[model samples]
Target: MDYQVNYINPEIKLSNYTGKLFKTEAAFTDHLLVWLISGETKIIQADESFVFGPGSTFLIPRNQLATIINIPKDGLPHKAVAMHLSAERLRAFYNQESIKQKNTVSKIFSFHKHPLLESCLASLIPYFEMQENFPENIASLKITEAITILSAIDKDIGSILANFDEPYKIDLISFMEKNFMFNMSLEKFGYLTGRSLTTFKRDFHKAFSITPQRWLTKKRLELAYYQLTEKNKKPVEVYYETGFENLSHFSFAFKKQFGFSPTTLQKIKTNS
Candidate 1:
């Protein structure tokens, strides 16, 4: 499908002035993140009801049904920022697998308070609605800051972005893509981003929703799977080249994710 990458990561859409009682359900094509500022708003996800006050945020996963309830109409009411992000884009942006990134997902949905965040969200509202003259470009940078501020306010999310901020995160992801075949360590990753191990782990989870180890393992295994099946590489070659220390571990993880062992999948490919 043709898609816009502008809203993929740290993208923001802001609107000032009051909100009215939402009379209809709103659905998104991707993950929806809403930060409520000032007044009170109610969000309903399935049977659950979330009451967001002045510093509360809510997340709605892609294709999920959600409703905005109790939108206040009194006076200027509340100003808010909403973001729509794709799972694939987020995974690619962080250079990690989407499945292992639970902490990152949690942070995206979690809500908290930050004066700087509020101000940033507030400032972006105008730009978000502009829809002209590099609006997406400006909004993309602003959204990156918004995500960082969100990470700072929440410890869980902090784990994901620990190694990333501003220009460095973008650069680091590019570096990883180029060096995925190399022997990368926590120390090297830390040095690349100027973060300590502990800090990196924390932010990694917070931003990406997956531990670095888990992400790396999955990446390696995924590459191995593609090579064994598509490239017709031998299992031993795939295992060693993918950086797995042990063949058994690689097979186990591969089966766990793909629902079948690599040997089984390869045989099926050959038979077909």
Candidate 2:
């Protein structure tokens, strides 16, 4: 069977396919709501892991490192409807609320009883099935509708959607430590830390005594090492989670870092 995964544009996306595991070394750029239609979808991040099936909805926060596993049920194609939440569309609805109030962030993943979601999806899926290039306004409204349902259920969610404060540099070290798992360009890392590309390089050297590239590589390799040697995880399982895009790169880096290939851990586990 040929392997394929589709992600067409316009925010409202439909994916129907089958695969063992799809790896993404980078983080999610936008917040997303996904409802599995005909398969078991499993997502694992460094901090959390979840599995969802038919009619199950998952809300994934932006900038979280995750690997998705897709398995079809009953020999059918895996199907899902996903809505990507862009900052622009969210800001429109956010402006109506009190943006000054402080609220803790919503979790990266959450499960809820949202009947509205089912109804909206029922209406939205037909557009995808018909291969219609629907207007952006229509899709944008769907995004707002999802958020509205969320805010009705949880006020904190409303606050998160409303709060779009620009990233700043006051807490550079802390921010990097928290977000380094995201496989983004150094420029993006700089931007998220509220610094220009050049300024980020200079400040990064001052704080860490190394270039951003070297630091990120070392940090990611360290994470892989801990998970492999200490937690006994497989290289394929943790490669994407630790910010490596592919297993070959992960294996090479692992051997360079700790003087042994990642598979050594698995071999040790099997023998002992």
Candidate 3:
């Protein structure tokens, strides 16, 4: 099927959504980006599991296997847009003859904040829903905004080319992905990361804009959703697998995070 972005412009297309966990090794013919609006996805690349959440963006390289994991049951409302840059198109769009011909395939990247990109997504609904004038150009403008933001924010370039790089706050996130299934606790995490509990907690909050407990709570909730919808696992199994103390705690937390009880979500899934 043609991706949604294709209809808007010949250069880019948005793929359709599959509600369940997506486990595929597909290839992208053009440069692609998936804007995840909600829920969480564990994208497995080689030995790495990259956890992508709301407002997260990832790249799919041309002709590569992208094994998507932990597709949320309440499949996140998301949009995937791709662009196949041509020399003519590049010149017309940016008035630049030399847009770098980088072989960016199947790579993962993140943008914590980009106003143009944020604005583009905000306008997506109206741009598509209303039968307004110059929709193509308008959507094109949004795509351009996304491209511009990406160019400005992509840090991989300077680090590799200039050899000057600093650590990102996401190093902790990488550690979490590797150790989430283990008996990981706040104290243990602090110890492993070489910081005192108080300092670690403060730094984590400053970095993610949420307390570590809150972050762990959200992560566990996401894990539970994945287990419930994708794994077809029992509630008891989910509770323990997600590191919850008991069923009561799991149910309470699940309800709070998803606005529906686990049983209710299961029933809906079964019926559908």
Candidate 4:
């Protein structure tokens, strides 16, 4: 079944985009659900690889690095719609008393072709295609509807989202690799990695010869450079996506390391 997404209406929370046949490295700040309208996607999550085609739907856990390569089928552009669930929004629906928390790591989940979920997504086409700024109230309901349907399929889905347990010590390496894009403090990183500040520093030094701060800067800049020159992404978009707080700071560091600012690099790429 080929679903053609000729219409795209992007709102604050809901996004529709066309994919290119290039591998992209990104981490989701919020839990994300993606529905492929057509074409194929080969995504690497953690150490796992999953392929999806038309009518395929999947959930991507927040703070996980996803390396996605769009595999267009029959010369068709890879189209996808993604819904993001923010921490605040998910917490509003969470109930620790009723939903049992599980101590586990977050990973991607694949879903079979679900008629109800498909229909729900189909019904949203009009809201975006017909008008601009699709009603936030309705958008909120759509997300809620998605959660309900997912809960019916797997009760653990809800629990996995609601529980906020720090990552276990063993899982720290994987968590940091996926989540370094986020502009979180060292203490926060330690907490999420289930380590105290002292322990985190010790473990981090053992894992990488350099300090965490230095490593993070290098990693972010490395990702940003690719996004700008290779992906042709704007400086502002690259900065935000790679976790830089201010453009000035990002630009300063970028110039120092790369010998040119992002804006200059973007222009060079565009002209060439």
TM-score: which candidate is best? Answer: 2
Please write out the lDDT profile of model 2 over residues 188-229, one tens digit for every residue. 777767799999999989999988888989998888878877
Compose the digit string of candidate 3's lDDT tens values, residues 77-196: 334444443334334554542344444332556554456565555455443344435356765666666556666677443222221122223466666654454335576567655567
Q: On lDDT, who's better, 3 or 4? A: 4
Across 1-272, the per-residue lDDT of candidate 1 in tens digits comes to: 11112222254544444434432243444566677765676654433556777777665654334445435444645556677555544544456423233445422255556576667656654454344454456655665666556655665553443322222333445444444443456765655565677876776677668877877787777788889878998775566556565569778888898899888988998999
Model 1: what TM-score? Answer: 0.42
Kindly provide the TM-score of model 4 when superposed on the true structure, using C-alpha atoms: 0.61
Off by over 4 Å in 3: 1-18, 73-106, 131-134, 155-272
lDDT of each candidate versus the true structure? 0.58, 0.73, 0.57, 0.73
Instruction: Count residue pairs with overlapping backbones in model 1.
Output: 18
User: Where does candidate 1 stray beyond 4 Å?
Assistant: 1-11, 16-20, 96-108, 126-132, 152-272
lDDT of 2: 0.73
Candidate 2: stretches off by over 4 Å: 1-9, 25-29, 41-46, 63-77, 97-100
At residue 263, give the lDDT of candidate 1. Answer: 87
TM-score quality measure for candidate 3: 0.44
TM-score of each: 0.42, 0.83, 0.44, 0.61
- Candidate 4 local Cα displacement, residue 201, angstroms: 7.3
Q: Which stretches of candidate 4 lie over 4 Å from their true place?
A: 1-20, 95-97, 165-203, 210-272
**C-alpha RMSD for every candidate:** 17.4, 3.0, 15.2, 8.8
Candidate 4 minimal-lDDT segment of 10 residues:
7-16
